[model samples]
Structures are given as structure tokens and as C-alpha cells.
Target: MRGRFGVHGGQYVPETLMSELGQLAEAYEHYRGDPGFTTELDSLLAEYAGRPSRLWFAANLTADLGGAKVYLKREDLNHTGSHKINNVLGQCLLAKRLGKTRVIAETGAGQHGVATATAAALLGLECEIFMGLEDTERQALNVYRMELLGATVHPVTSGTQTLKDAVNETMREWTRRVADTHYVLGSVMGPHPFPTMVRDFQSVIGREARAQILEAEGELPAAVLACVGGGSNAIGIFHPFLADEGVALIGCEAAGRGIDTYETAATIATGSLGVFHGMKSYFCQDDHGQIAPVYSISAGLDYPGIGPEHAYLHDTGRATYVPVTDAEAVDAFEYLARTEGVIAAIESAHAIAHARKLVPTLDAADSVIICLSGRGDKDVAAIARYRGHTVKED
Candidate 1:
């Protein structure tokens, strides 16, 4: 399997897990390029996960912004309300192909957890999800959703109670059950096969969007943007456009309060190169090189380390990664809801926020497409609280 995205991705897991990883890598490499596997995945994507998500022209938003034409690659409309289902379906199917009986994953905001649960249910595989205790509390709706899908949810209470901790716990669980279990890693981070596998699964976004945009606008857009949360959705949408030098690949990172403050998840904006989570990548860490506590208004972005591909992209300056503050993301979330009747996940809003800033600087003929990664229904309560409102539940 292709690893080391320009010196960033590699299998750095514990020695005990190397064999498991090697087996997975071999299976993935074979299945990924096989026509039978491709046919099955394509059919499942169309019938179950809703393939070919829309490329909607956000007319009102573009007009309001008073600059470039704006289009939204609507992954938000996918089944399970996020682009996460794409990878989950592929991984679960691979697990079945590998004769694995169970699948497990770690989630931060619960999108991945919900998607994993949905895939496992559809595939008739036992599923377990590890979510940080803090995430479980913040995303209780998703926790219940997972249980409803017949997956067990384990709340991890260690290490800032966030995405990183959930990953640590999931790796531990995988180590214990390697023979019968496949860990459905949620992002383009982690070891070699996972980053490559997840990215290939997600590349459908960019592939479709590229052709759709060209058909609609008669040319490639000036830029394609997506919010980075362990960089799955971003990588999914970015990988296809990598060779098109005319199209800029932009990733928006969460600046919880601001990059100036310690409470931020702007990994590329302020992180240093380090190793964690079985990959060599940039991470938000302290002077002593310990992973630092990270914060983001969007739970999905609250992780210390980013996907290794993102690290490589940053290093090569092939992609531009910038910080989008919580205030900006929140404002964009509300703005899209009011102006375009679109309620986007706070994580997705980070990209929209950056788009707001970027679009105004471009000509009207220029176009920008943002990967709307998920619906905001999951973040409604949190948004209300952020705006100092309370929703009374019946």
C-alpha cells in the first residue's frame, strides 16, 4: 500500500500491532483496486449512502458576499448527515471482506460514531465506538443514535476527554482484539494504510465536484475549501484537485478563541512536527513535546494532531491551511442559515467562514466551492448555547 505522503505517513504503531496493520494494508491494497470490490462499493454508495451529493450554487450567499460566485459541495445531505459515511461504508465492507466480525471506531463529535454504527448495522457486523466522556456529554444525541443502531458506546474519560483520548482508547481496544476486529479510523491521520484508505474512500467528493463544477460553470473553480478535523473531509475533497494547479486547495483549521490563545486547534497555524497516534505529523504540543490540550468550539476539530497528508501538504506549501476563529465560524453558521437557509455543522462553518473572507477578495467571475461536510442539526443545541439561548426539551 502507498504510505508516506511525502514523509508524513507511516506505520508507527506498537510492535504488537504491526502484523495486524500489515494484514490490513495487504487486504486494502488488493480490494481497493479490484473491480468486484469497486462495483459493490459503488452500488452500496448509490443505494445506501446516497452517492453523487449535489453541487448547489449558493446564489444568495454569493450575492451577499459581493465577490466570487459560490457553490457548495453538499456532503451535508448525505445519509447520516455527514461525509463520514463514505469512509465508514468502505471500511466496514473491507472489514467484512477481511473476514472480520467486528468493527470499532473513535469519534470526537459523534459524526464518525454515528456513521460507523450505521455502516456496521447495514453490514451485519458487531460495532463498538469509543467517544471521549466530554464528547459523549456534548453529543448525547449521537451517543443515543449509536445505541439505537446496535453499537456499544464506550466513553473514555482520559486525556482532556476529547478526540485524542478516544483515539488512544480505540487503539488500545484494537490491540486487544486485532484478530477479529477492524478499527475504522475516522480521519486521514493515523498509520499508513488508514490514511491512504480513508482518503481514497473520501476522494469521491472531489471527483464528483470536479466534474459537476466544470459542467455547471464551464471551468474549474478558483479554489476548493473544507474544514480540517483530522482532515478527512478536507483530504477527500482536496485529493482529486491536487494535480489541477489552477485550483487552490484550502483547509480551514479551528481557532477556538483565536490562534493567539492557548484554547485553539489550529494545528498547522501553530503546531510543530511531532509523532503521535502512529504517524509522523504536526501536533499541538508543549515545549517538552508532550501533546498539549486542544480546544475548539467545534468538537470535531478539537484534536492535538492532524492527518499526516495535511502535514505534508503544509510542508510542501501545496495546500494552504489557515486559522478560522470560533466567532467567525459561528457567524458563518448563522449567516448561512439565515441567508441561504442552510444550517451547516460548526466544523463545516469554519470553511464557510474562511470562504467569506476569501470570496470578497476575488472577482465575480471567480468561483469557490466549499465542502459542506455535515448538517448542523447535531450542533443546534450547542449553537443556541453559544448565542446565549436555551432550548427547552420536552
Candidate 2:
């Protein structure tokens, strides 16, 4: 009940992990309010992780769309090149306070893994990362980056060999050695304090965006858009805007091919209510209740389930989730590069693709903020391959 977001989240973890989760929840509550912790965390965010990321007005794109003014919340500019760093720094610091000597995490596209390894190196903690074997291939550069930061990257080959499998292996690893280790779960999925805790850490996006947009436009935007894999970036920017009913929350899911096909990861579009990965949320599952294999061009958006709080938001009509196909996302990925001179991550292009659709319908006076979740440098080679170009690595 403590973790439930209208019955979507709970401690569906193993009994052996219950006590560890409880202790984590308790420690999070205490340290979150502790002045020393807050001060140190704030300083690290500003000095290390590059807090207060810019909110830039996309004048060229807005004029081309010819309707709503477009603004980009530039989380890509943060250290390590993604919004993942925010949550990793918070969790790794908390792990230190709890006297954990090691930190382990699950990652898909490897942004979270890179970020976690960075924080662990900074805080002097031993780090291990579990990534899907398939993703390790798609994101080989990130694997090297993580290793350079002193992390052991374990490629998981089980259960479709994707984000879902990575989570499973990380959870099992956590259960095996809970005493001296903390699991720095990458997204807002998972049990109890995690969804809530990760949201709080990532909410800096929304808080800064809200202030910046108001100062720039003198009013809240018509909508805030972010791509949802496990829904960390979406919830991060959506949380502070929840009370402002005028501001719409939109999450773009990866429709790998299309929602009509089995090869898609649009959980909100094609999934049903189910429990998986220690959270009761919408998941892509088959007739027998087994998790279905999911696909997305962007390795970051390949998860089969969304965060539990996102399920609550969808059920309550506080947010709208829509599917964006690989074709459409790739088009937007290239379009943004040509139009705005910005090379956005393929994961973020899903949101940009939807914004291209939505902004055309809104009035010219209206504005929309899209969370540019990460830099596209890691995705360029993969994106080139997706577009039928051969990428020769050195």
C-alpha cells in the first residue's frame, strides 16, 4: 500500500529482497531530508552532473511546423550525455551513505550503465552493470565507455536478450549479494521507493523546465513530451506539471515497426495490465500471460513495460501515451538534424516525431516542450545502419 500508485506499484520482489527494499525505503526517507545529504547532492548536481540544463527555443522548427512554438529541454547537455546521470548520482550517493561497497544496475541502451559507472568511479564504489547481449552489440561504444569508467559490464543472454532480460539478471544479482551492494535501478520502474525515489531525482528536469518556460513565455506550455521506455524521462518532466491541468503530459512509446505487428514495444498501446519486474504495470504479454518479445530501433526504448506511475497516469487520464514507429522516429531524427542543427538521440526522436504531429494541431500562440533526453552521438552508427548505410567500425 505504501508504494501503490493506485494499485500499480508494490513489493512484488522475492521475500529475501523484502527486508533490503524496506531498509532502502527507510534510508531514502531519512537522507532525502538530511541537510548534509541535500547540500552535497545539490553541489554534485551543479558541479559534476551539470544541473540546470538549458531550455532552448527551436525557432526554425517552430516556424517550419507553423503552429505551436517548440522548446527543447536540453538534458542531452548533461554530463555523460543523458538524463540518466541525475538518478545515478542520487542513488550512488545514497548507497555510500548506506555503507554499500558496490553498486549494480540494469541498462538497455547503456546510457544508465555509463552514468552509473561514472558515479561509482566518482564515489569510489565498485560497479557492475547488466546489459542485454543484443543491446551490448547495438551499443558497443557505450560498453567501452562504461569499462573506461571502471565498471564490469555483464551481457545478459536470457529472455529475449533485451532490456527485460537485463532487469531480471540485475535483480537476481542483487538478491544474491544484498549485504554490501545496492542496485541502482535505471528507470522509474521497480518496487516501492524506486519509482518514487527515481522520480524525485529526475524531477529536476520538470522543475527547471517549468521555471525556464514561464520566464521565457510567461505561461506554461500546451504540452510536455518525452519518450517513454521505462518512462523515467517522461515522469521526470511530467511530475512537476501534474498540478497544472492546462499543461498536458504526453509520452511517446516505441512502435518498433507498428503497433499492429508483434515487433513493437509500445506498451501503452498494445500491452495489458500485468505484473512484471516487481511492479504491477502495463506489459506486452501474450495469451498465456508470458511476456512477449519486444523490439525498437532505439535500444533505449526497447523495454516491454512502462513505469508503474505511468500506468496510474494513463488510467487517470492525466497523461496520454502514443506510439511512434521506427520509420517515423528515424525520419524525425534526421529532420531535427537538418532543421534545428541538433542530432537528438533516436529515443528522443520518438517524442520529436509525435511533436511534429501534435504541434501542427495547436494554435500558433501555444507552446510545447520536448525533453531531448540524450545526445545522439551513441546512436549515429546504429541510425546509419537503420537507414541502409553501412557503418564500418575501426
Candidate 3:
């Protein structure tokens, strides 16, 4: 019950993993409050991962929209070029404290894998990354980046050969060797402690954004928006704002083609309640209860399920989840580049696409904060292909 977010999260893992989970939970509880651990993690965040990422006012975009003032929480500027580094550093440090010699993780677009590899290298831990074969092909640059940081990349070909399959393979690997290894789950989607833990690590985004927005505007923004794959970035920025009744939490889910088509990965829009990947959450599943294949132009947003905490937030009306089609996201991706001279990740463009829609409805005096979750360098080639441009790689 401690892990359950209104019955959406639990230890749905195998019995063999129960004890390891217990040990991890205990260690995390102790280290989370331990001053030494906190100091080291804070140092890593500030000096290594570049914490306190800038919150920039998008004046050009705001004027173009002719509605609410727009602000971008620039997590894209962090080291390794994504918000994934926040959770990765924390988990890898915890693994070190637990005396684990190795760390393994599952990644989709490979941001998490790259970040995990980075942390493992910094902390002197052996690292392995399980990624979908489809994603490996889509994000080959990131695979090379991970390898450069000393991580072995395993491409999973099971299931739909996507994020879900990567998670499955990583979990299987963990079960086979739990004694000297730690599973650095990439998102807030796993069993107990993980969703809560990852949220805590990533909440730095919301905390800093809240302070910066108030200092700049003298008030909270009308809404905070972030793209939701497994919902780490959304929950990170949404958690601190949960108590502010005036602030709205919005999660933009990937609607690959459209929610009407089977190719969509908009879990909140098209999925039903189900248990998968060690958590009970909203998943894209067929009528027979089998997980359905999901698609998104952004490899990062290709997951078929929303995190349990997000499901809770949706059920309680504390947050609103909406679908952004690939066409719309790509448009936003390019629009941001032209308008703001900022190349946002395709994953983050989903949120930008939603913000383009929502900001138009709000008063000019109102403001909205969009979490620019990652830099777009890794996606430029794929995005070019999506736009019918032939990209020749060296």
C-alpha cells in the first residue's frame, strides 16, 4: 500500500525480486535522508549535471501566439542534454552506496541509457543498457554516445521491440543477477520506491521552476506542461505545483498518427487500466488484455503505458493528459526552431504542441511553463526523415 497511488502502483514484480526490492527500498529510505549522500548527489547535480537549469521567457513565441506569456524550463541544457540525468545520477549513486558493482537500465530514445552510462562511469560502476531494437535503429547516435561512456548496449527484439520490450529484458536481466547489480529504472513507472524515488530526484525541475517563475512574474504560472512517455518529466515539474490550486498540470502524450489509429501511444487517451512492467497503470492494451503495439515519431515517447502516479493524477483531475499527434509535434518541433531558435527534442515538442493549443485560450496576462525535456540533436536526423528529407549520415 505504501507504493500504491490510489491502487495504481504495487510490487507486481516476480517473487524472486521481492527481497531485492525490499533491500533497495530500505537503502533508499536511509540514503535519501543521509547528509553525506545528499551532499554528494547535490554536488553531482550542480557541478556535473548542471542543475538549476535556466527558465527562459520565450518572448518571440509568446508574441507569435498572441496569448499567454510562455516560459521554457530548460532542462534540455543539462549535462548529457536531457532531464534523464537527474534520476540517473541519483540511482547510480545509490547503487554505489549499496555496494552494487554494476547498474543496468532500460531506455527508449537512449537518453536514459546515455545518462545512466555517464553516471556509472563517474561512479565507477559497470553499466549495461537494454534498449529496443527499433529505438536503436532510430537513435543510433545515442547508442554510440552510451558506448563512449562505457556502457554495453543490448538491443531487445522481444514484444514490439520498443520501450516495453526494453523494460522486460532489463527486468529479466536483473532477476538473473540481483546480488551485485542495481536496476536504474529510467522513469517513474516501476514498482514501489521507484515512481516515488524517481519523482523525488526529478522534482528539482519543479522546485527550481516554481521559484524562478515566482521571482520573474511575481506569481505562479497558469499551467505547467511536459511530455509524458513514462511521465518522469511531467511528474517532476508537476509534483511541487500539486498544492498550488491555481497552477494546472498538463501532460502531453504521444499520439503517433492519431488516437483513432492503432499506431498511437497516447496511453491516457486510448489505454485502459492494467498491470504491466511491475506497476498497475493505464496501458495501451487490446480487448483481450494483451499489450498493444504503440508508435511515436519520438523514440522517447514510444512507451505504451503511463506511470501510476500519472494515472492517479488523471483520475483525481489534478492533471490533464492530452494527445499530440506526430504531425502536430513535428510542426511544433520545427516551429520552435524557427521562432525561438531553440531545437527542442521531438519528445518535448509534444508538450510544445499542446502549449501552442492551450496558450491561445488563456489570457495574455497568464503564463505557461513548458518543460523542454531534452535537446534535439539526437532527433534532428530522424526528424529530417520524418519530414521527407533524406539525411546522409557519415
Candidate 4:
């Protein structure tokens, strides 16, 4: 638990990054031992980030899905309206405790950027977010949100102008300014302590899911599901349920078209082992072992690699990973919006897509929990454009 979870994690960065990770690891360990860190984080979650987000029974949706009970862990209801805040606050506070004056992060779809910006604003930490140029164009509202919250946004114009490029840019910046800056990676992926540390910070979802489900049903669920992008949201909700024999953890990867040939970011479903952005994990790579271009209707799921812990979980069969196609996710997104009046993030819709299939297979008495990772407002335009239409506000 102290080091890499097998080969999936380590300080595999350039020699220049060794001392940087070492400094961060030492500071993080020191903060972990400090009660003040715990107290501050706890108080923030209670008063600000909305700890213990509700687990609501989606009876209508379950009934529509052939009568198997389904519950939603409403992480979408959090302060910045996503599960990202939980990790952001923790890392930003840790950065402060480490005497870092500024915090920086790399983001794909801008959920992490908004969350990091919110944390920076709350703690008065100077913050910068690196976003792929394409994503900045698509998710302009999030860019505006970050700027409004006092965080500077840099567009990553390198390497196809996508998430991978953003990550590379952020790491380069971190390496150049490691003295008084901390890189708060926005996922359960990345090198060394980041994967482990982010998971610990995000364990609140699983912790809440377990208690809420038991309180509602007097027993744990048959399965728990979350969409795996960089895998933080999924791991956050799956880790606390790993030992339960009756409970299965399902991580849904994005199959933008299908996993077999093209247009997918199904890292564990179809990816091979490779190194990208400092960590060796399952990644979508071509025949030459070069990182392949990824596509997804959901900006958040359009990444080539998943988190290291997810790689381990997939291999051990402790968690099952299935690819959910963009078409399938879109269908589910519309279904949930129409049925429950809850418009879901397309990243979140991947989990809901799985639930649509999972519920029907379960007995009427069986129940499943889905992590509602974030709200859908940021996705409305993307979803509309993908559908070749506009979504009229309700």
C-alpha cells in the first residue's frame, strides 16, 4: 500500500522528476500524519464540498429496466457539481501544507479544471490549468468558469491538441517549476504517489455508498458501477467494496464506436501495456506501440489510458471492465433525462448505460449502485451537436 500497486505505478518519470516526486511524497506523508490536515479536509467536505452525497433509489428507471433495483450515488450534487472537488480540495490543502504557493493541474474535459479552480479560490492558492486546445474550444464555458474563479488556463496546442498533450504540457510545467509549485493531477492515473493518494482522497464515494446502501436495504448491493476515464471516479466508488463477495465492481470504458477496431478509449477493454505520461498501464496504442488517437462523444472519456489501480483490478478480476459505446451512452443519457428529469454528464451516462443492461440481469430483489459523476450542463451542447440538434432548456 505504501508504494506502487504492483508495476502499474512508480516514479517512472525522467531523472529530473525523481526529486520532485520525492519531495511531494515526503510532504504528503508528513501531511497524512498531521491531524490538522485531516481536520481541515473533513471540515471542508462537511461544509463546502458536500460529503456523504446521497444514494437515491432510482425506482422508476429500475422499473423501466426490467424491475431490478438501481440506486444512484449523487456525486453530481457536490458543490462544483462533480466528484472532482473531493480530490481537488484534498490535494490543494496538501499543497498548502507542503508550503507550495501555487497549484497546477492537467484536465481533459474541464471538470477537473473547474474543480481545481474552485479549490484554489477557496484556499487562496494560485492555480493554473492546462487544457487541450480542442477541449478548450469545446468546453469554453468551463474555461470561463476557471478564469472567473481566479485560475489561469493554458491551452495545450501540442500533439493533436488533446488530453494526452495537455498532460505532457502540465508535467513539463511542473518539472520546470517544482520549487514552489505542486502538480495536483486530476485522476487516479499518473506516476507514484499520485495514483495512490488520489484514490485515498476519493474513497469517500465508496465509503458513502456502502453505508447508504446498507441503510436502505439492510445489505450491500449486488454490484457497483462507475465510468472509468482516468479512473478516479470509479476507484473512488469501488475501492471500499473490493472485499465484499456478493458485490461486483464494474468500470465502464468508453467505446466511442466499438472496442474491436476504432474510435474507442477502452483502455482495459482493448488496450495493451505501455507507458504514457509517466505511468505504465493499459493504454490504447497502435501496432508500433505509439499512443493512438482516442475519440468519444463525451470529452471526459476521450483519453488513451486509464488509472493504474484499474489496470490491476482488471487483471485480478476483482473488478470487471466493459466498454460502453458512445451511441449506447447517448441513448442512456436521453433515457435518464426523459425518465428521471436528471440530465447526466455523458461520462456519467456510461455508467448508466451499464445499469440499463445490468439491472435486467439481476433478480427483482437485487440492487446496484451507479456513480452519478457529474451534472450534464457542461455536456448539453456537445450532446446536442452530436445528436445533430439543439437541446432546449427545460
Per-model C-alpha lDDT, please? 0.94, 0.96, 0.95, 0.90
Write down the lDDT that model 1 would get. Answer: 0.94
Return the TM-score for each candidate structure. Answer: 0.99, 0.99, 0.99, 0.97
lDDT of 2 at 312: 98
Total clashing pairs in model 3: 0
lDDT of 4: 0.90
Best by lDDT: 2
lDDT of 1 by residue, 79-191 (tens): 99999999999999999999999999999999999999999999999999999999999999999999999999999998899999999999999988899999999999898
Better of 1 and 2 by lDDT: 2
Write one digit per residue (lDDT tens) for candidate 2, span 287-382: 999999999998899999999999999999999999999999999999999999999999999999999999999999999999999999999998
Error (Å) of candidate 1 at residue 133 is: 0.5
Instruction: Give the distance in Å from residue 147's predicted Cα in candidate 1 to where it truly belongs.
Output: 0.4
**C-alpha lDDT of residue 377 in model 2:** 94
